[model samples]
Target: MVTEQHSFITSAKRVIDIEAKVISALASRLGQDFVDACTMLKNCKGKVVVSGMGKSGHVGNKIAATFASTGTPAFFMHPGEANHGDLGMLSKGDVMLAISNSGETAELVNLLPVVKRLNVPVIAMTNSKHSALGQHADVVLDISVEKEACSLGLAPTSSTTATLVMGDALAVALLDERGFTSDDFALSHPGGSLGRKLLLKVSDIMLTGDDLPLVKHDALVADALLEISHKGLGMTGIVDELGVLVGIFTDGDLRRILDARVDLHTALVQDVMTVGGKTTQPEQLAVEALNVMEAHKISALMVTDEARKPVGAFNMHMLLRAGVL
Candidate 1:
C-alpha cells in the first residue's frame, strides 16, 4: 500500500513539474506579439468574443470572465454554437480570441470565414502559426507545450495550462495598461468580500442617530454601561457638554474598573473612560477602520465628524455582520 501511495505521489509531482516548466518557458516567448494582443484588446471598442472547443472552451470561458471582471468587456461564444445561430453575437468593432491547442480545431476553423466577413480581427492561441486557425488570425499567440502532463500524451493538460496562462497574460496586461484600479474591480464584484472591503464605507455599516451608543461626560460609569448594553455595540462614547466626543468606555473598561473596585454609580464616565480613544470618520472605508481597530487591539470605534462630535459607533461584530471583517 505504501508503494502504491508513493507511485501516486511521484506521478502527481511529475505532472506538476512538467506544467510548471511549460509556464516558465512561456515567459521567454513574450515580445511584440504579446504587446500587439494587449493593444488589440485595449483598443477594442466592443466586447472581446472568446471561442474554443472542449477543454479549450472551458479555459476560454474562464479567460473571458477574467477579461470582463478586469475592465475589458468580454464573453465566451462556443464555436459549435457560433456555427449555428450564435455567430450574430460577434459584431463590428469586436475582437475574436480563438483558442485551440492544434490551431486546426474543425469547429473553430469553420467559423473563420464568417468572422473575416464581419471584419472581426482574430487572435489565435494555438501550438503552430502554420496551421489553419493561426494562418487566418491577425495575431498568433504560441500556447504550445513541450509535452503533455498526461502519461499517455493524449489528454489536454500542459497545453491547456499554457493557454490559460497566456489568456491571463493578455487580461492582466490590458488591465495594467488601462490602469484598472481595485475600486474598478470592486464595482464588478460587489457581492464578493473584496468588494465589501474596498467599497463599503464606515457610514454605511455604523450605528447612527438613536442607535449610536453615547453618554454625557458627566454621566456616571453605571449610566455608560447601561447605554453600552442598550446599544449592543460593546462600548459607548462619552461626549462633553458641547456634544463633542471626549472619551470612550467599553466592556474592557468595565472589567478593569471592577478589578480596581471603582464605584460605577459615583465615578464619572469621563474620569474612567479612555480619553480620546481611537476614532474613524464617516467617509473612511470600513476596511481602514478595521485596520485601526486591529492595530489598537480594540473591537469598537466611535465615528466622529471634523469637530469631534460623535456621529456614529460600531464594533467588530457589526463589521463581521456587514462582511467588512
Candidate 2:
C-alpha cells in the first residue's frame, strides 16, 4: 500500500511537471500569431464562434465563456452540429476560432468551406499548421506540446493545457484592448460572488429610514449607547441640529469612556464622539465600503450623501450577509 501511494504521488507530480513545461514553452512561441489573433477578434463586428471536438471542445466552451465575461462577444459551437444546420449561427462578420490538437478533426474541417464562403475569417489553434484546418485559417496559433503527460502518450493532457493557456492569453489581450473594467465583468457575472462584491452598492445593503442608528450631537453618551443597542450595529451616527452627519460614537468609544471614568450620563455625544469619522457614499460599491472599514480598523461606518448628510448606516455584518465579503 505504501509503495502504491508513493507511485500515485510520483505520477501526479510527473503530470504537473509535463503540463507546466508545455505551458512555459508556449510563452516563447507567442509573437505575431498571437498579436494577429487578438487583432482579428478586436476588429470583429460580430460574435466570436469557437468550435472544436472532444476535449478541445470542452476547452473551447471555457474559452468562449472567458471571452464573453471579459467584454468580447463569443460563444462555442459544436462542429458536428454545424454541418447539420448550426452553421447558420456563423455570419459574414463573425470570426471562427477552430481548435483541434491534431488540426484534423473532420467535423471542423468539413465546415471550413462554408465558413469561408460566408466571408468569415478563421483563426485555428492546432499543433500542425500544415494540417487542412490550418491551411484554411487566416491566423494559425501553434498549440503543439512536446509530449503528452499520459504514461501511454495517448491522452490530450499537455496539448490541452497549452491550448487553454493560449486561449486565455487571447481573451485577456482582447480584454485589455477593449479596456474591460471590473464593473463590466460584474455585469456579466451578476449571479456570482464576484458580481455581488463588485456590483452591490452601499445603499443597497444599508439600514435606512427608521433603521438608521442616529442620535443628536447634543444627546448624552448614554443615549448614543442606547441607540447603538437598539440598532444592533455596534455604533451610532451623531447628527447636528440641521441633520448633517457630524461624528460617530461606537462600542470602542464606550470602552474608552469607561476607562477614563467619564460620566456617560452627562457627557455630550459630540464631546466623546469621533469627529469626521470615515464615511462612504450610497453609490459606492460594497467592496469599497469594506475597504473603508478595514483601513480604519472599524467594524461599522456612517453612510453619507453628497451633502454630508447621514442617510444610512452599515456594518461589516451587513457586508457578510450580502455576500460582499
Candidate 3:
C-alpha cells in the first residue's frame, strides 16, 4: 500500500510538471502569428464563433465564455452540430476559433468549407500546421506539446493545457486591446460576488434618512449610546449646530471611555468622539469603502456629501450582507 501511494504521488507530480513546462514554453512562441491573430480578432466586426471537438470542444466553450465576459462577443458552436444547422449561427462578419490538438478532427474539418464560404476568417489552434483545418485557416496558432503526461502518450493531457493557455492568451490580448475595465466585466457577471463589488455603489445599500445613527455634538454620551443601540450599527454620526458632520463615536470609543471611567451622563458626545473619522462618498463603489474600512481598521464609515454633511452611512456587516466584502 505504501509503495502504491508513493507511485500515485510520483505520477501526479510528473503530470503537473509536463503541463507546467508546456505553459512555460508558450511565451517564447508569441510572435507575428499571435500578433496577427489578436489584430484579426480585434478588427472583427461581428462575434467570435469558437468550435472544437471532444476535450478541445470543452476548453473552447470556456474560452468563448471568457471572451464574452471580457468585452468580446463570442459563443461556442459544436463542430458536429454546425454541419446539421448550427452553421446558421455564423455570419460573414464573424471570426471562427477552431481548436484541435492534432488539427485534423474530422467533424471540425468537415465544417471548414462552410466557414470559409461564409467569408468568416478561421484561427486554428493545433499542433499539425499541415492538417486540413490548419491548411484552411487564415491564421494558425501552434499549441503543440512536446509530450503527453500519459505513459502511453495517447490521452490529451499537456496538449489540452497548452491549448487552454493559448486560448487565454488570445482572450487577454483582445481584452487589453479593447481597454476592458473591471466595471465592464462586472456588467457581464452581474450574478457573481465580483459584480456586487464593482457595480454596487455605497449609496445602494447604505442606511439613509431616519435609519442613520446620528446625534448632535452637544448631546451627552448617554444620548449617543442610545442612538447606537437603537440604530444597531454600533456607531453614531456627530453633527454640529449647522448639521455638518463633525465627528463619529463608535462602540470602540465607548470601550475607551469605560476604561477611563468617564461619567457617561455628564460627558459631552463631542468630547469622546473621534474627530474626522473615515468618510466615504455616496457614489463610491462599495469595494472602495471596504478598502478604506480595512485600511483604517474601522468598522463603520460616514457617507458625506461634497459639503461634508452626513447623508448616509454603512458598516462592515452591511457590506458583507450586500456581497461587497
Q: Could you tell which candidate, 1 or 3, scores higher by lDDT?
A: 1
lDDT of 2 at 129: 94
- Ranking 1 against 2 by lDDT, winner: 1
Candidate 2 on 1-325: residue-level lDDT in tens?
9999999999999999999999989999999988999999999999999999999999999999999999999999999999899999998899999999898899999999899889999999999999999999999999999999999999889999998999999999998888899999999999999999989999899999999999999999989999999999999999898899989999998999899999989999999999989899999988988988888799998989888999999998989999988
- Give the Cα error of residue 13 in candidate 1, in Å: 0.5
lDDT of each: 0.94, 0.94, 0.93
Worst window of 10 by summed lDDT in candidate 1 = 32-41
Better of 1 and 3 by TM-score: 1
Against the true structure, what is each candidate's TM-score? 0.98, 0.96, 0.97
| Tens-digit lDDT string for candidate 3 (223-272) | 99999999999999999999899999999999999999999999999999
Cα deviation in Å at residue 194, candidate 1? 2.0
Higher-scoring candidate on lDDT, 2 or 3: 2
Clashes of each: 0, 0, 0
Please give the RMSD to the true structure for each candidate, in Å: 1.0, 1.4, 1.2
TM-score, model 3 to reference: 0.97
Model 3, position 129, has a per-residue lDDT of 83
- Residue ranges of candidate 2 with Cα displaced over 4 Å: none
